[model samples]
Target: MNLRMKIATGAIALVSAGLMTFLGTWEGNGQNVVYADNLARGLPTVCKGVTKHTSPVPVVVGEYWSDARCAEVEKLVVQKGQLTLADCLTNQQISQNTFDALSSHAHNVGTANTCASRAVGLINAGRIADGCRALAWAPDGKPVWAYVTDAQGRKVFVPGLYNRRRAEAEMCLK
Candidate 1:
């Protein structure tokens, strides 16, 4: 190659390498399936209608899902969660772990709720530690009251939500 063309090629290579390094440094790897698994662990499949904690809407009987079906739902949930994070976060760059945690949180609480939550606000404000803490308290800030009134007038906490929040918080901190 000519001297000028060689220099230009070398410059392009350097730029590409730098860009790849920069992207690698930021832990934004797409781990949607992992996040969905975390969510599924938190929200187990049930064969009957049940009320999800802190959510006014009840999970209808027909909505109960498991196995592949559950995975499909979780996939959709993670997608929504990602969109919610994109919409809510303005300046903060998030890692794969952070995305997984937040996606799971959004799946449980909902995209709108997660976007409007204190966690998102804190994250946007550059208070990542505080944001993780807020994510831990995602159950409407009530970790102790693991149960809410179901459609049958029964007060019972949805299984695994508290533990799920804790896991999400830990993931965020990582």
Candidate 2:
């Protein structure tokens, strides 16, 4: 092949490789299906419809957790047939624009971390709609919260689950 053709071919290969890596583990479906199944129960699934709406989830950050014995509910969220935390939070009741911004923020914080500040910022900036929204609350019984970890995994929980709200969002932040 000529130099131009070789360069074009190399570019295509590089793009393909990058795309595959970005997709993470998948079977043409960006899903770590095996990984999901192999984990213990309550490890959180990426699937949305299957997520229990009223399910009580364990909240933990660093080490403190709500009901130290309970586990976090695990659910899978898929975007474009590829499962991702970004897809789950976005696709679930939340709007598309919000989803995009949240997705970007999640990426910036590493999908798993998906910092609570992003959600708080959205609400504070008035980008998010007014109403009840799900967020991990501090264990002390306040409104603000950051990251929630459990014996199973770490994730944000819907609001109603708390009696008066777990703890304010501010308690968990560093």
Candidate 3:
């Protein structure tokens, strides 16, 4: 197959896998749950029988999980994350990869912000490239601020968030 065909095939497979994972149909291991970058980065979580936190802090507490608990939390988060995207993106037709990537970002940032974001505006206007580029910015269409405190307790830019935005932008392009 040609390179284009190969890429198309791979994207399809990825989308299918992502959908299954999001829907809780695909059972992932504890490692998968623990290693999800967004999860570890202090994104909002939905643990069963546990009240969800409104404003989550950006730190991982490793001592707070059993294998069963981790899996349950992962599934709940994934399902809720997809729902957030669906709610915000009502009536819009987007590719699976775009949906997955944007849902990941929206999951971290919040659905309200994602719904009102410049990226969504651009997307709704059918300016796909511009919309993808907008993913690198904050939801308000400005540069994302650095909130991570440094050694001296001063806020500093987080390279990880920058990298994550870049990855999301790349995925939107795909």
Q: Write the per-residue lDDT of candidate 3 for residues 1-174, one digit (tens) a residue.
A: 432233355532222455434323212333422222332344323322112433232224333456566545545555555565565564345666676667656655666777788787787677777787788876566555224555566667666666667777777778
lDDT of 2 at 40: 24
Which regions of candidate 3 deviate over 4 angstroms?
1-16, 19-51, 54-63, 138-155
Sort the candidates on TM-score, descending order. 3, 1, 2
Cα lDDT listed for each candidate: 0.50, 0.31, 0.54
TM-scores, all candidates, are: 0.53, 0.22, 0.59
What stretches of model 2 exceed 4 Å from their correct place?
1-82, 86-91, 115-174
Candidate 3 colliding pairs:
none
Best by TM-score: 3
1 or 3, greater by TM-score: 3
| Model 2 weakest 10-residue run by lDDT | 165-174
**Comparison by TM-score, 2 against 3, better one:** 3
The TM-score obtained by model 1 is 0.53
